[model samples]
Target: MELGYIVSGLFVGFVVGLTGVGGGSLMTPILIFGFGLSPLRAVGTDLLFAALTKIGGVWSHWHHHTIQWHIVGFLALGSIPSTLITLQILKTFQYHDQQLTYVINLILGIALILTALALSLKGWLINTIKANNSSKVVLIIRHLRSNQDFIMISTIVTGWVLGFIVTMSSIGAGALGSVALLYLYPNLYMNQLAATDIAHAVPLTIIAGLGHWHLGSVDTHILFNLLLGSLPGVFLGSRLSISIPDRAIQITLSTLLMLIGIKFIL
Candidate 1:
């Protein structure tokens, strides 16, 4: 069972490296459906897994000077408070395992579906935002680009929403965060956007993960095995990413995630 957990982590880490998606999005679902863990436990365990795994990314990005600290601060300002509120809500239902499981499943299913859609539409969204046209979407994007205050406020609001969803489902801090940042800060480089998203996500996941631990949902043994396999897996996958076309991988992954989401919902 421990070996199985390690293999699962390796596979998930590989996919994450190839697609730049968050580990929680893939790992939590695998823990639930594949390993027969309860949804609450899966989410809690994966949150900690994500926080630990992403520390390396945060360090690398910091050294490269790609991270935007101010953006991370803005996101944290909203997410930290929202995460605390969410944790309190979870605490209220800690003893009602069945009900909490149902809630987590429902939210996780929705989050996965939304994540699939975000991955599928990412290219179109970027193109639409960049295109000089009279389309309503383009117009709104342009307006957002021109307004600094609106952008900042929107980032905070986005973070607030991400906090709640990520705490509940452990699935939105990567794909959704990147997409929202791209929309709000179109002029920023992709690396900078990714760096800022990851920097924000680390602390958010840490807080959420610790809250879940207090709720007694985390499995430290499984987390340790997963990390052992995932580190090397990420390295290998990143090396191979240069050889494979990411679009094809993203499309296939999106379809699979959508189906998984539907399965969970049903």
Candidate 2:
């Protein structure tokens, strides 16, 4: 691979570190749609790339005692079996590579739309949750709990669909999933919500990455290249996050996703 190719990895890593978004959403699409990598290779490599990065994040959360194991369990409950079904889906269609490209295009479109919406709606959601703070949200915050069965069933079903989509497209697991969780548990403490999402992300990405590996889709060299930049990128972004504004980051990410989506669609 050329040093320029690795530069894409570094740039993507820097953006991911700065915004905590767009690992698969931006990277895989750029690889396939911009750089013209095969969709199969892009998805596989990005899956492993996500897993590796999230492991580091999970460790940080664990050390801080910030990980919400309960929420993670709920998300895993939804995502794991779905991941298996996704693996099966990939197996059936692995030979029909062209269709996979179309799917990637479609997913790139959807991911962009969702990320844009998430970016705009996140501020609204946070504000609304704060302004119209209801007893239900307040109660949940005071107790910091969720109904057991609801969480489990939701998790499994959510995981199932996301698993299939993410495995097929390498999109949705980041901003989309986080946004979904935020809506479902509108009352959740934001920190706890982030912690839960990251915790959930670990297993979801790992399972999908392994499945891709089994299918011979993963490109380990590419994955390592992504990690080389993303790890340090996260640290660099943290240093700058305080100075940069959240709304600006969100808007920029949304716009980037939109542009990428339009490119894929057209």
Candidate 3:
């Protein structure tokens, strides 16, 4: 069983390296459906897994001067408070395991669906925002673009949503954050967007993970096995990412995630 968990982590980490999505997006689902972990336990375990895995990314991005500190700060301002509140809510329901499981599964399903849509639409959305089309969505984006204050507030609000969803589901801090940042800060380079998203996610996951730990949902032994496998997996996947057709991978991953989302909901 431990070896199975390690293998699962390796597979998930490889995919994450290739796709640059968050580990929680894949890991939590695998823990739930694949390994038969309770939803709350899966979420709790994955949150800490994500926090630990992403620390190196944050350091690398910081060294490369790719991270946007102001943006991270803005996101943290909203996400931190929201995380605390969400943790409190979870604590309140800790005794009701069935209800907690149901809520986590429902939210996880929704988050996965949203992440899938974000992955599918990201390219088209970015193009549409850049094009000189007179579409309503483009017009709204343009309006938001012109209003710096609104954009700043919107970033914070995006963080707030991510905080609540990620605390409950452990699935939104990466893909969803990137999509929102892409929409709000169209001028940002992809690296900058990714770096900023990761920078914010680390702290959010840590706080939430610790809260879940306090609630006794985390499995340290499972987490250790996963990390042991995932580190090398990520390295190998990243090395091979240069050779693969990213569009194909994204499409397949998006489809898989959508199906998983539907399964969770049903």
Please tell me which predicted candidate would have the highest lDDT against the true structure. Answer: 3
State how far residue 107 of model 1 sits from its true place (Å). 0.5
lDDT of 2 by residue, 168-237 (tens): 7777787777776775667677666777777888788888888999999887877777677777776777
> Quick one: how many clashes does candidate 1 have?
0
Q: What is the Cα-based lDDT of residue 91 in candidate 1?
A: 92
Q: For residues 55-161, could you state the per-residue lDDT of candidate 1 as single tens digits?
A: 99999999999999988888988999999999999999888988888889999989999999999998998898889889887887797779889988998999999
Residue pairs with backbone overlap in model 3: none
The window of 10 residues in a row where model 3 has the poorest summed lDDT is: 16-25
Return whichever of 2 and 3 wins on TM-score: 3
Between which residue pairs do clashes occur in model 2? 78-155, 78-156, 79-159, 82-160
In model 2, the worst 10-residue window by lDDT is: 137-146
The count of backbone overlaps in candidate 3 is 0
The TM-score values for the models, in the order shown, are 0.98, 0.88, 0.98
CA lDDT, every prediction?
A: 0.91, 0.75, 0.92
Off by over 4 Å in 1: none
Q: Candidate 2's error at 135, in angstroms?
A: 14
TM-score of 2: 0.88
